[model samples]
Target: MEMVDWNLAVATATRLVRPGPEVSREEARDIVAELRRHAKASEEHVRAFTRMEAANPEDADTPVLVVDRPGWVRANVAGFRELLAPLLGKVEERRASIPGGAVLGAVGGKVTGVEVGMLLSFLASRVLGQYETFAPASRELPGATESGGRLLLVAPNIVHVERELDVDPHDFRMWVCLHEETHRTQFTAVPWLRDHIQMEIQSFLGETEIDPSTLLERLREAAQSLTGAKPEAEEGADAEDEPSGESRGSIVELVQTPAQREILGRLTAVMSLLEGHADYVMDGVGPQVVPSVAEIREKFQKRRATGAGRLDQALRKLLGLDAKLRQYRDGERFVRAVVEEVGMDGFNKVWTSPNTLPTKAEIAKPADWIARVHRKAD
Candidate 1:
């Protein structure tokens, strides 16, 4: 099997593919063991990578975070390869230089090899007083709870579909890899991005207030419904259940203060711009490289629509903890218009730095940027 097969296999960790008859407990155990092997291998890969890098590493000299199962790394690398491989052609040196390049598990010896690469990249920037630290978070996995500072961004998609429905898997994967790296690059390029995001979130949370009484009741109800049991009823609930324990016990989320609303509006604009710009670049480059971008985008959206709905809600509630804006499609369209009117170079200028990037007004009305850009150019 290929890389995508491995991806699908790992994801089906607990789920048994029972065909003719019910799967026996032993069979399920074996399947779980197989999945664990991937994790183990990933761990080993990371160790080996660290050693290798220590010997002859990237310029940053920062610690490399190697893993064997970085789904994001794999997907992004495949995407980039799809686009650059055919057009500019493959050159290992140049590929390494791709701002936020990451290698997926199957083709690599380490987990999301490019993750380490990206760390190295940002580390270099940091040395030059670019920023403080890079925030590496986890991917949102269903049923999987988060306890750590950030969710391990390991569960992102690796099984790439063709860029076009008619193309082969290789290009499809490459295109996705490139797409992710594109976002990484944007973040790395804008040093204050990490702080900016955190600041916005903090500001939102600080001002936005929650009703402690109502929130607690809603959460209790949710827990009761999902488990058919309460926390006190279960023995060692942490091990028995997923890790989505309540850091602050409650639900419905507290209401945001007026001051919080101000920050939230700004934060939303920033995220939209980033996400939308990524989609624009990735989608634009799809036809030029991968044949499966359309397929991946279509299936992914469909899946998000059907089953991933809960995750969508859970994420908004947890992260936003307050405000929730559900018009991502509209946001993406607005960003796309800006790019279409000018080009990557022009759009990038807007992101030359936080000061240059679009403010809430510009994002709300991208056409407003037209005047700004013209004024600057003139």
Candidate 2:
């Protein structure tokens, strides 16, 4: 039996997702058309700035879809299904071994579906755009044989953010497209990246050995951490000074074993690199391309720092978005430092192979990556 009612998850998300800002049908069409044009235009700027080109014709022609909040949620649900298949299959095997497992799964699936839907509904509005690496071939554009993945610009969210920030709509849209197009360039330029990340995720999930009984307890602890309730040992301690694994802001951190933590570190480093590089490229390409880039960046940074309300703050921590924000800051610093020390050509060596990728420590200390990767110069 399926562990999650995927169809139900979609329905629930569609029902719960908040409506985007009101706009006339004509205005919406204009926004969508402009976004598609900007996506294509940003590709050239990204390629020129990063000097990373698509590896093949298919990659070069990767599709860009302009979607609303519900469409974005649906696409992500599909991606989650594809990415979690291995782990779900494993869970199903374990469930089969237990008595009354079939009935338990039948009831649990709907509950899990609802939970997943709620999570997606929360995220659907926050995301601006994404390059979906695990997109299935069935969703590929016509005449495309294999899935090179597709870029999705969440139209409503993009419009919402630009309006909220009070920036030039045209400039803001192109700026957002610049960042997202950099991601498309990253995956398409590096032929091995998508598979490498997929393998790493599969390896991590393949090793998961969760006890069904203890799952609730772990979740409780994670919730406590997000709510600022400290354990006895951590009481009166500075949260900033806490060791890596001890600072549990999210359930992702709370449930991980030591081995899983190690894997997570590797994944974190990779994500930091990707996010940071995108920031770096966007800024690098901004001044010439985006006329109001300065104003947008300043306002966006302030918005990120201030965040929304208490409930939103707690939810951001619970979802590990706080850490994601850190990734952009930390990763951008690493990229900027590396590029300053060695030109973009030298930094490009990082894409040569998986072995050359920065470790978690190196992401914080650019000199370390430089020393390790460019030791011959020393």
On TM-score, the leading prediction is 2
Please provide, for model 2 over 252-358, each residue's C-alpha lDDT reduced to its tens digit, 9 standing for 90 to 100. Answer: 77767778878888999999999999999999999999998999999999998876788888888788888899899999999999999999999999999999999
Give the root-mean-square deviation of each candidate in angstroms: 18.8, 1.8
The clash count of every prediction, one per candidate, is 40, 0
lDDT of 1 at 52: 15
> What lDDT is reached at residue 71 by model 1?
30
TM-score of 2: 0.96
Q: Which ranges of candidate 1 are over 4 A from the true structure?
A: 1-157, 160-169, 208-254, 308-328, 376-378
TM-score of each predicted structure versus truth: 0.47, 0.96
lDDT of 2: 0.88
Quantify all predictions' global Cα lDDT against the true fold.
0.42, 0.88
The candidate scoring highest on lDDT is 2
